[model samples]
Target: RATKSLSLTATSPINIALVKYWGKVHEQLIIPANSSLSITIDQADLCSKTKVELIPTAEGAEPQLRLVLNGKEDKITSRIRSIIELMRERTQGVRAHDDQGHTLTLDASELRTHSLIITSENNFATASGLASSSSGLSCLAFVLSQLYGVSESFPDEYTKFARLGSGSACRSLYGGFVQWHRGFQAIQELTEDSAKVSDQSLARAVELSQESMEWWYNNLSILICVVNPGDAQTYQKDVPSTDGMKITLETSELMKLRLEADLAQKHIDQLTGYLEERDFPKFAELTMKESNQLHAVCLDTYPPIFYMNETSRQIIKTATKLNGQGNIVAYSIDAGFHVFLFTLKENQVKVHEAMSVLPGIDQIIITRIGREGVKLI
Candidate 1:
């Protein structure tokens, strides 16, 4: 008998959503109310490097997985193991080989020991509140999927699975203003017979075509106000982000307004049209207002959750007031404290210079439209 191993490496960027994905409807599935948009960043300087190996081992042993942060051997939990187990089930008969070049079977239950070494590093310092966890989790799920032999043919499902680990992660799966469509729950309200018929019709009517959706290509820049810089920490101390959102949905009336905002619909339509027309000033105006509206709801939360600070607020004001010419720049933030400044490449240097003078801030991380969600190495 021989042993074989598969080593795969992938990198993903931390994204800042223009329209935030703060709340969730389904905790386990991580379904959001509305579609959120984002642009991926460069992976060279900041990313997660993961290596998954499968080995044939003796019986009656506890299956193991390991995570290494920097050079230290950190611990792994059952939740992490469950993620691998789920992948194993979905990828049965998919095998890796050891350095000896012999095939090694990957059975989650049969394995007594395993090594899933994950090493993540960031260009900026840790605790900066830059949504780095979103990128890291997305990359982790992505690399594991490849090493475990899950087919890449279904990009949507693959992205949805990645979202289970981090909501913003689904956006990281696509490049250049990717939208996560949280389709209306009209299906949930259907009668059983009607639901079956509707499902069948949807399956048939879904056309896989690209000709109609190709107008979105253009040059857009996603600039990060990278504050505080070390590695991003997992939100394990609080309720799972998904569960926190569920609790919010139940108690927060603002969440209700967010779900049913008529003006918001109008704003989205007008902004989308403005985007298409390249109306820089109007687009930037709408983007700033919409982001403030989203944050208002966060303020309405009981006990309140503040995702911004004096510096973030001042940056918004400075950018809005200082616009004297060309392409207008827009700003948006997510659950974390960092700001995502968007503009055309021509206006980037100006925006960069303007933001450089703001107080209590660090450097600006510049990223353009990314290539794709996950790439294999």
Candidate 2:
């Protein structure tokens, strides 16, 4: 008998959602309430690197599985465990895309019979909002699937398993402009039983080819200013983001008008056109309007959670002043204190310089929208 070991590693980049994913539809399945659009950031700036290994285990001994994050061993979350189990069951070869579909046979594959070890690490700084988690899980799924040859066999299921860990994680599986379709019922129709799943879903993802990568990569820039360089876990607030969204969904009048798939599609249509034509003014307009709309929804929340602080407000005012003078610079803030300045590459220098001196801004992170996604190594 011969001892055997197999190993592989992969890296994936973080992303910023232009069209935000706010609420949840199926909490148990991690489905989003609405569709979302995003672009990945450069892996060099921020990413998650994961390595998975399978080694022959002693006969009759129970196989072991372990995961390490940032060099520290930690217990695996149930979501990740679900992904592992799904991968194990897939060894018998895939059937149709139906969730109720079954494997052909219960074959003890190489992966199932061996002890496994998975290690992942994020390249982040103090100002990081821990945005790398999505990329981390995405990288883990990518590498393991690559080893199992899932990208060619069952690409949709590969992405679907990533979403099991985090809703946004599915989007990081692709590059360029990406969309995550909402609702599970609608998603089933998007995939063909025997064909490739080209479109995206809450359980899967699709990457859209906007302008060529070269065009956007050279023309667009995002200047991220960390107004509050604090860990999201350590930061305290009146209402947690998830709780705040739930309150808004139930009580806010604005939520009644805005939380619909039709609205998302309308915005997606116009934004997609603007992106292809490089219409900075229209692009900036949508960016600013959608951002403010999100904040308005926050304000309309029952208890009114304030993710944007005084400094955040000041940056908005400053950007308004710049845009007043015929500049296309726009800003967006997530449910956090950091502000993102979206501007043309030509004006990036001026936009970055003007925002750097704002009071309470601790650090400036210069980054362009990345043109690629996860890669197996």
Best by lDDT: 2
What lDDT would each prediction earn against the true structure?
0.60, 0.70
Worst 10 residues of 1 by lDDT: 199-208
Estimate, for each residue in 111-225, the C-alpha lDDT of model 2 and write its tens digit: 5767879998887652355465579888887787765545664556666767777777877876667777764444334322322232235433333354444577788887887
RMSD of 1: 5.2
Model 2 gets an lDDT of 0.70
TM-score of 1: 0.79
Model 2, residue 20: what's the lDDT? 73
Could you give me the TM-score of model 2 versus the true structure?
A: 0.82
Candidate 1 residue lDDT tens string, 250-360: 667877777766344456567656655656678677777778867787677665666666677878887876665643788887665667888877778888888898875
Model 2 CA deviation exceeding 4 Å by range: 58-62, 93-110, 183-213, 229-247
Candidate maximizing TM-score: 2
Candidate 1 error regions (>4 Å): 56-62, 75-79, 96-115, 122-126, 186-218, 228-244, 262-272, 324-327
Scored against the true structure, residue 344 in model 2 reaches a CA lDDT of: 83
The superposed Cα distance between candidate 1 and the true structure at residue 322, in angstroms, equals: 1.6
